[model samples]
Target chain A: MIRLHLPQPLSAGAALVPSLDQSRYLTQVMRLKLGDAVLVFNGQDGEWRCVLSDILKKGVVLKAEAQVRPQTIGPDVHLLMAVVKKSAMEFAVEKATELGVRHIRPMLTARTQGHHLRLDRLDAIAIESAEQTGRMDLPVIDDPAKLADVLEGWDPGRRLMFCDETGGAPVVKALSALEDSGRPWAILIGPEGGFSPQERERLRALPFTTAVSLGPRVLRADTAAVAALTLWQAAVGDWER
Target chain B: MIRLHLPQPLSAGAALVPSLDQSRYLTQVMRLKLGDAVLVFNGQDGEWRCVLSDILKKGVVLKAEAQVRPQTIGPDVHLLMAVVKKSAMEFAVEKATELGVRHIRPMLTARTQGHHLRLDRLDAIAIESAEQTGRMDLPVIDDPAKLADVLEGWDPGRRLMFCDETGGAPVVKALSALEDSGRPWAILIGPEGGFSPQERERLRALPFTTAVSLGPRVLRADTAAVAALTLWQAAVGDWER
Candidate 1:
């Protein structure tokens, strides 16, 4: 069954008025007709079985039938990545959602080139990726902020996994050492030019920061994010469950 | 320094003439002049510093300098993946090279969509990735073969890590169990449509095959390839070193 991410509260017998965009996706793209079943999730009320109840010129309406799955979220893994090129940034967001990241924080570092990002565009990408990857919840994409400011008001309780391209302790070992801490974690990936010297020093000096190396060969910023998340999952995230 | 992948054996004091494409890239695109320094690597001879000795109309001549780094290869990890669509297949090849795959064997499964692949195109992607990722060696792309034929001649000494989208043992757990064995390893990732029932049965029943789960979510074929490679590296590949 096709899955859709509905933002409104879901309940049994509630009518879901999909937006024009979604209606075109369902009616025109997917060719779904009235009475066709689809799975719907509101990221709060869990997943529900729904059917197209009405089709109109402007949009389509769905009637929720029954709740299929209880609401659940993945581990508290937040991705704090430096703003990269447009295409790479989009790729990162899509893959992060599939890997079950709970939040995505785009940071502006000294070497970050582009500063502008359409939040709506990223939100759409996240929603589509979640729907396709069977994720019940969507990752919150925070507005882009300066890395220094974000770190200044940081919660010390949450561990920061800094992916240092200049080489550090192996990621598995660094993450394994934190296995007993039981703290929420975030991964920070630098830009293509990599973290500036001052930024690296500040991160390395922080008590909450654990600098981890992805591997011997240098990886592009996007690849580093994926590799780091995978290592984290295998070491201390939900993959162990 | 610009890096180029030269297939010929390289040695100090040898005059190296680049291909027309590489000459255009060096002279026209990069605007490199005679006497400009570049790094060249052939899978066998490690990396060497080369100086542009002559700039001709069609090609460029280079003089090999002292070796910069000794030849090194990543862990013996092969990738056996079903041929996917053109773009996704190219993406997989690029990522596999960045992840230090030693060999890539494209297989034709029952559900594989594309039957033909441009080996030269894939080789170019791999070379570019290897050059950018600071890898000394290049992965050999094998001719496409039927999965059954490839399995029939499989070496029992090498272990196969099958990334099954369906539920299976967690990848970390599955890989941890293989820590004691010092045998070579390869990863198998299916196409987007997944393996046919008969194909899955054959894989699952194999004594040397270990079915591993990436996570709970359904990952596209490209994502699965990257995640599996990351898991393998962290568990038993060079990342552990």
Candidate 2:
């Protein structure tokens, strides 16, 4: 069954209007006809089984038949990644969504290259990944912010898993030490050029930040995100279940 | 420091010549003058510090100064991934190299999309990733082979970690049980359409194969490769070192 992420509230027998793009996908691309069954969900509501009710000039309406699954969120893992190239940044967002990240915060560090990021495009990628990956909720993509500012407003209660390239304890060891903490966590990945001296010092000095190395190799920013997230999931997240 | 993957043996005071593309990257892209220092490595030999010795029209010559690091190989993990789309397949090769897979064998399955893969392109991607990620060696990219043939000729001593979409034991749990068995391993990732019913049944019935689920959500082939490799590394590979 095709899964669609609709923002509108859903309930049994509720008529929901899909977006223009989604309408084209359903009517033209997928060739789904009236009364065809489709799965739909909003971030707030659980997944629902719906049937195509009517076709309009601009869009189509879907009628929710029954709630198939209750809403559930994954671990509170935020990705504080530095802004990389456009392709790499987009790739990070898509993979993070599939890996069950809750939030993506693009950080602007001293070594980060200057580039304009289209938040709408990133949001679209996140939604598509979530829909395809059987995720019940979409990750919140935040606008790019300065790394200093993000750290300044950080919650001390949340442990920060900093992926340092220079040298640090291995990720498995670092995560093993935190196995009993049970605190919410976020992962920080630097840009291709890596973190500047000041940025590295600041991150290391933070009380809540724990520096962890992915391995001996220096992975690209996008690969680091996936590897770090995978380690987190295996060690502390829901992968144990 | 710039890193180059050279196939020639390296030693103190050994003179070497680079390929045409590498010369272009050094002269035009990086704008390096003669006598500039760069790091060079071959799969068999350790990394060496070298200096530009000569500049030709098509290639450049370098003189090795000393061995910087000794050759080291990662775990004996082979990736037997079904051939996916061109971009996704290339991405998997790159990430697998960065994540320290010793070998990559592209497999053809019933549900795999038909496409021509340029082995040269994949080798280049692997070399570039290894060069950038501090890897001492490059992974061998095998020609696409039938999944059945690969499985039939498989070594019974090596365990096969199968990422099954239908469901199985969680990855961490499955890997934990293999902690005592120090055998070589291979990971099998299916295509985007997933494994055929026959393929799934055959894989599950194999005694050497251990089916593992990444998580609750379904991951794209590329993400699955990264996540699966990361999990394996954390549980039993060199990350524990």
Candidate 3:
């Protein structure tokens, strides 16, 4: 069954009109006719089974039949990635959603090249990823912010996993050393040029930061994001469950 | 200092010429002058420092200076990935190299879409990644083969990590149960639609296979490849060193 993400509240027997793009996808592209079944989920609501109730000039209307799955969010981890090239940045967002990140923040550091971000475009990608991955909720893509500002406004309660390109403790060992406190966590990945010397020094001096090395090889910014998230989930998050 | 992967042998006082693409990159793109320093590495030889000795109409020549870093190979692991779409296939190759895979074999599974494999293009991506990642060796991209045939001639001595998308033991626990056999290993990732039910049955019944699950989410082939490689490295490979 095809899955679609909707923003409206969902309930049994509710008539919901999909957005323009999604309507075309169901009617023209997928050629789904009236009475065809589809799965729809809003971030707030659980996944629900729906059927095409009407095909009109505006769009296709779906009638919710029953609730299929209750809403369930994954780990409480967040990712703060420095702006990279367009493709790499987009790829990181999609993979982060699939890997169960709750929020993604585009950060700026001293060495990070300034790049314009299209938040709407990233939100669409996240929605599509959530739908495809059977995720009940979407990962929020926060507004781009400078690293200093992000750290300054940081909630000290949330532990941050800093993926330092420079040498640090092994991830498994470092993560294993800290018993799971079930605290909200975040991961920070630097740009391709990496964090400047001053930024690295400050990050290392931070109290809530846990600096760890991914491996010996120099990984791209996007690769580092996925790797760090995987390690965090495996070590202390919900992978074992 | 810029680095390039060259096929020729490297030694002090040996004059070597770069290929046309590399020559353009060095001269036109990077705008290098005579005596510009570059680091070159061949799979067999350790990394060497070289300087542009001459600039000719055809290309620029470099004379090897001295050895910088001794050659060291990462884990003896291989990746046998099902052929995905063009962009995803290329992305997998690049990520596999960056993750320190020793070799990559593109396989045709039951559900795999029959996409033409461009060995040359993938090789170029792998080379560029190796150069960027400071890898001493280049991971060989093998000719495309059928999964059944590849398994028929399988070497039982090497363990196979089958990333079963249809649920298996958690990767951390499964990989940990085996006490670092230090034996050769390979990872098998299925295509987008996942392995056929028959294929899954056959894989799960294999004796030397260790079936593992990445997480609850539906991971794309490329994401699974990176996640599996990272977990294997952290668990048994040389991430600590």
Candidate 4:
């Protein structure tokens, strides 16, 4: 069955038209004929079983049959990663999506070098990942913002898992010691050059932040994001059965 | 402060010669003159502080001043990952080395596609990752072998953590439930298309195998490797300080 993350509202008896790109992909690339089964899920609606109803010259229309799965959400975990190079940034976003993060915020640090970040490309990657990973909804990809500004407007209710490289407690020990409340959480990853001294000091002072080191060695930004998410999920998030 | 991974036996007051590639990198690229401090480490020896003693046309010679850090090893964890594409395979190796995996064995499965794997290239990646991540040792990259053969010759004492996508116990719960017997462990990650049914059955029947699911969604081969390592390290490996 072909799974797609569509933006249009999905219902039992509504018609949905795919985008031009999707239309060409379905007709020309995949050669999905009329009446072929296709699973579609809007971010707001549950996953729906649909079939190609009509194939037009420029597009294709789909008719929903039934909802195969209900709307579900994963644990509220966000990733705030300093943007690295183009390839690394995209790779991190895709991995974060697969790891079931709720949101992705591109962070800007003093040593951050990747300035040409695009929101649309990241959204596309998230959508593709969600479709492939069986995720019902897409993670909200926030715009790139300065780390200081993000910290200033932060909510105290959500604890932050700061992946500090210079010095910190071990990941397992620090997270195992934490008391799990029903609050949100986020993981912070710095750039390849790492955070400046001033930024590190400020982050260390945050009350909700729990600075934890991955291990004895240093990791690239993308790898750190994946490792941090894995540890956080296994410790407190949705990795438990 | 530059770090280099040298294969020669390192010791105090020993003159070491670098490869031609390293020679150009140190003299032409890095522009290191005589008496410049350089950190060198062999997989067997502790990290040594070396200084440029002689600049040769073919290679550079360095004198080991002192051992800056003692030789240390992380938890004995091996990664048995099926060969993925070129980029994903290399990325997984790099990440595994940074995560302190002791050895990496490329497993050939029914759906494995990347056949042009070079041992030397993978070794280079491991060495570079070790140098960059401040790791005291490099992971041993084993030759690629059929999954069945490797499992047939496997030692039953060392447990295998299989990342099964179909169904199994959750990662955290499953890993935390295991007894800490100080036995070596290995993580088994399937190919992009996943393990064959026969292979899966064989793995499940093994007495030492503990099949665990990452989450509801499926993950790529590289992502799965990192996640499994993170959880395993946290549960029983050396993540606790």
- Each model's C-alpha lDDT? 0.89, 0.91, 0.91, 0.89
- Candidates arranged by TM-score, highest first: 3, 1, 2, 4
Clashes of each: 0, 0, 0, 0
lDDT of 1 at A2: 90
Provide the lDDT at B32 for model 1. 93
Chain A: TM-score in each model:
0.97, 0.98, 0.98, 0.97
lDDT of 4 at A90: 95
Choose the strongest candidate by DockQ. 3
Q: RMSD, each candidate, Å?
A: 1.7, 2.1, 1.4, 2.3
**Which residues of candidate 2, in runs, are more than 4 Å off?**
A180-182, B180-182
Itemize residue pairs with steric clashes in candidate 4: none
Leading candidate by TM-score: 3
Q: Which stretches of model 3 miss by more than 4 angstroms?
A: none
Question: Higher-TM-score candidate among 1 and 3?
Answer: 3
lDDT tens per residue, model 4, A1-241: 7788888988888999999998898889999998998999997789999999999987999999999999988899999999899888998999999989999999999999856998899999999989988889999998899999999999999999999888788876687678473469999999998999999999999999999987767788898999999888777776665
- Where model 4 places Cα greater than 4 Å from the true spot, the runs are A179-181, B111-115
Error of 4 at A178 (Å): 3.3
- Between candidates 3 and 4, the one scoring higher on TM-score is 3
lDDT of 4 by residue, B1-241 (tens): 8999998999889999999999899999999999999999997789999999999777999999999999998888999999988888898998999889999999999889866898899999999989988899999999999999999999998999999989888776677778563689999999998999999999999999999988776788999998898888877787665
Residue-level lDDT of model 3, residues B78-197, one tens digit each, is 999999998888999999899999999999999988798899999999999999988999999999899999988999988999998878898877886786646789999999999999
User: Which candidate, 2 or 4, has the higher lDDT?
Assistant: 2
Give the clash count for model 3: 0
RMSD to native, candidate 3: 1.4
